[model samples]
Target: MAKKLGLKQKYQMMTRGLGWDTTYQSMDKVYPFDKFEGIKVHDWDAWEDPFRLTMDSYWKLQAEKERKLYAVIDSFAQNNGHLGISDPRYLNAVKLFIQGVSPLEYMAHRHFAHVARNIRGIGPAVAAQMQSLDELRHAQTQIHTISHYNKFFDGIHEWRHMHDRVWYLSVPKSFFDDAVTAGPFEFLTAISFSFEYLLTNLLFVPFMSGAAYNGDLATVTFGFSAQSDESRHMTLGLEVIKFLLEQDEANVPIIQRWLDKWFWRGYRLLTLVAMMMDYLLPKKIMSWQEAWEMYYEEAGGALFQDLARYGIKEPMSAAVARKEKNRLSSEAWAIFYQYTHAAAFHTWDIDEEHKAWLAEKYPETFDKLYRPRLDFWEKEAAAGRRFYNNALPQLCTVCQIPMGFTEPDDPTTICFRESEYKGEHYHFCSDGCKGIFDNEPEKYVQSWLPVHQIFQGNCGGASVEDVLKWYRMNLGADNLDFSGSPEDKFWSEWHRTASRAEAAE
Candidate 1:
């Protein structure tokens, strides 16, 4: 054999010799969108991907992992694996995944494709290309993994439509849409740094662990597989942030602004995740407050300390986020519990045991601030009347979540902020959302707010049933209280039948 090539040499050979001088057209004309964002890239070659992956090696590794993943999926499907889950209630977490998160993978795929094509450097471009494929794979695998559950579940069949039209889903959709619409550098900063590196573990870990604890083997497999790729994506995020900061001191403030804005946006989007972790899973892994402290406060504290050498401090409103960690999950679940009839997922009052668990998990806030509300709801439920908030709740113009979050200092009052643009009033759920809108009013004013669309006759007809029909919700089956719902009835009957067979044997 001839001389063997080293990994770094092969990466360079594949990435370095790919670009050509353009005498026929100007560089700016070729890449028109790169300059408008005010990013300064003095040397494109200065950008280095830490992964050092060539296309050949990349395909080989990905193919092997996917083959292993599909093998597990097939085995699960042929054996009636759905019956082995901890409870039917656990599938609600899967429904939330397919509805709220799977489509985001596809959106990430689309944006990464744009980044791959538009950016001028070969190293970054190739990295983006790999990430684009990784995201597309994640979307497909998530859907494929969850499709087995759809054979027996209610809310999963219409997830694509639900992602577009559901009220809670608008939170994630709007957050990704904000990132996808920005210029290239800002898009990378928004997604790669803020979302993937800083906040992704908080989103993925609990769901994966919950799946495992609930005996959903297929979901656990897929979650683990998707997270393996997340490591590379996280590396890419850190590299990009450092590369930008190293390139020019002027790039610092712009990145810090994007960091602050996207950090809060990503946190607000995770409010749904917090609720799912705390309230939805039948067998809980860790409390939302504990997970936040472990993942965000402890780990993120170290990350910021490392970045501080480059003049990057923690995000603005870090204090508010820290304070709300104790309270956001309860607040979000309460909103879902009241308005669940208008949603695609199910919700119900936690029993006394679960309430005690909450008290133990959130000693500072649960019994004092949140448990009384749960107590009142449980009483109402016992007396043969369940409380439901029928009137439409106002949505934040930016994040598109309901205005149910309370002020940080005083947890009694809802934190509401407003701005007037062109003599039309706009409302925000917090100062963070208002700040995002004020900085880019033109962008957010054009938001396709779900509530506004429902009122203006754009989403089905004007009635709640009409709106539910538009969302493809199955009413009593898919939405609303889960105590006596189809899923609950099925689970009870499942265990009862198994017991009867055992006794007969």
Candidate 2:
């Protein structure tokens, strides 16, 4: 036999063997999507495999992980891990995950599969194929992990249905929808580069840490399972960017524009995570402002500096986002508080204890700006007049967020950016969103705005109640304040009965 193959040699030989130039058809025909976006690649062979993982070895490693992961899941379920959480309110964050975030994993699966088929190089295509499988596994594992909570929780049961049509959910849904609809190169830049590389810690770390801090053993276990795959995906993100930049000098500006567009897009999409970290998790990991500073401000600053060698500067929205971080979570939470009557998950009416936390975390803004607003709502709730705004708010033509974000300079005034597309005036939440719309007016104009759809009699009916019914959400059980909801009452009753049993024993 020939000399036993070493690891790198095995990887190169095996990966290269996976793809061959088509005999019956030219590569232009086989990989039609490679050139349409104007991403010039002179040689497909230039793509260096980031990780040397073969399919057979990948399956074996993943199988072992799955076995360990399920054992932990079974143990958690048998131990009634749902009851062991820091608080019932903490599950609202979990509800948000299942409802808004988990479904994106499945979408990644579909599109990565598409990328694998359409990319020219064997190295990158094989990498994409593995990531597609990784995404599918993540989606399945998240459902299985969170399904334990569904037995007791109200909002999670209809995640897939709600992800497709719910008003607030359309934020993430639209983000991915735009990505998947783009050409393959743009998809890689958007999801793999911008999302997975630049902004993933903002999404993943906080959620995982919140689970651990909140006594969520099951979800923590799932996080442990996904850590390796997330690293691999992030590595692929960097590799894809560097590889594209090295291929052609002209691809630099094209890639830079994509970086700009997607940074803002990914930032807007992460508004949910900001709200979750600040408002939803009772035992908070860190304030959203702090996390942003640590993750994006410092870490991302360093990343962009590295890319400067390739003439890739930081995104245009970086300074704007840094300014808005001081205000992001507060504004996002305020919208949820106002619209909690129609929301699938419950939001608490901010009490003094919670207000104190907000004050401490957001000293500069909370006391001056957001505190008085919460005090008004708190006083109303105490006077048997809880404020609940059920009316649909105007949505940005691009980001789909309620038109609530304020000027970067002035936190008190609503920041509105407007553009006229083909004689029709459209609105945006920020310069970033307006810029996105200005670039692709045709695509942005066709956005499936839920508020607009509600007006046009498309989403179940004319009223919020009818729309909620169409969303398959139980009105009282799912919506309104978490403090005195049925879930809260049941938690107290269950614990009291358990206490009595222990006392007798």
Measured by TM-score, the strongest candidate is: 2
lDDT of 1 by residue, 378-407 (tens): 899999889999899999999999999999
What TM-score does prediction 2 earn? 0.98
lDDT of each: 0.89, 0.91
**Candidate 1 residue runs with Cα over 4 Å from true position:** 1-4, 496-505
Model 2 stretches with alpha carbons more than 4 Å out: 1-5
TM-score versus the correct structure, for each prediction: 0.97, 0.98
Predicted candidate 2, C-alpha RMSD? 1.3
TM-score of 1: 0.97
Mind giving the per-residue lDDT tens digits that candidate 2 earns over 1-505?
A: 3598878777877787778999799989988888989998888888887778988799999999999999999998897778889889999999999998889999999999999999989899999999999999999999999999999888989999999999999999999999999999999999999999999999999999999999998888888899999999999999999999998999999999899999999999888899999899988899999999999999999999999999999998899998898789999988999898888898877667777988898888988998888888888898988888867898998889999999999999999899997899999999999998998899999999999999999999998889999999998899988878889998998788777977999
RMSD of each: 1.6, 1.3
- Overall local distance difference test of candidate 1: 0.89
